[model samples]
Target: MGRIAAGDGESYARSISTSSNVEIRRRTRVTDIAQRVAKLMWQWAAHIVRRKDGRWGPKVLEWQPRTGKRSVGRPPKRWTDDIKRVAGIR
Candidate 1:
């Protein structure tokens, strides 16, 4: 294109910032609140999955014992493993 800076230096080219908006907590945006809730839920899910025995929500999420041996490498991936990967959980 002829115009190299067509969208440059223009506020319209920028996405809306969540921090600038006020939420019910008065200091955060709705997305922030939702994110906090989601993280908390994920943490709680980990806790639930750690239970020894139960048919609760997270029990299904947790990986189960392997009837056979695994290869000489990292274990097979689980849904919770992926969640932890994206959520930055330990």
Candidate 2:
């Protein structure tokens, strides 16, 4: 048995290791998930546009809620805003 003391007046009991106490940490590779998501969003949008079925996906995407009063702060960002921005159109 061994006592591990810290500078904050805290002590902990640790067992003496008969085996190796080495810790191995491997580096994680970063992924471009944002790019992949954006690509997929564009593909889905294209598919929805090409659909002949009377689905509401395209309609909902273009739909806007009309109200008499407006909030004080900035308006919320819409999904189509991102798609339009990425498509290089205003």
Candidate 3:
């Protein structure tokens, strides 16, 4: 650990990160990037939903800007919208 820290920090950091990723992949048995991202997003959404404490993240998700007006032909996609699209309504 000391040798790694004393050597090239960037390379060491990358190796550690890569090793953790491999461990996660082996544990979950999922390798594809798309699936991993989707799975992680779902997990994050579920976590935010289950939180009892009042937090800005969940509040922001539920908040609707009252004064905002559309300037373009189509509205931008939101994080929740993508999640719903991928997983379907519950």
lDDT of each: 0.64, 0.70, 0.78
RMSD of each: 9.9, 10.4, 9.2
State residue 4's C-alpha deviation in candidate 1, in Å: 45
lDDT string, candidate 2, 1-90, tens digits: 244457423322122223222321112334467867998999999998898688898897898867779777988788898888998988
What digit string (tens of lDDT, one per residue) describes model 3 on residues 1-90?
Answer: 356556698986786677876686876788879887988998988898888698787896776646677776877767888877877865
Output the number of the lDDT-best candidate: 3
Against the true structure, what is each candidate's TM-score? Answer: 0.34, 0.60, 0.57
| Higher-lDDT candidate of 2 and 3 | 3
RMSD of candidate 2 to the true fold? 10.4
Task: Give the residue spans of candidate 1 off by over 4 A.
Answer: 1-19, 22-31, 56-59, 62-90
Mark the 10 consecutive residues where model 1 has the least summed lDDT.
11-20
As for candidate 2, its clashing pairs are: none
Winner by lDDT between candidate 3 and candidate 1? 3
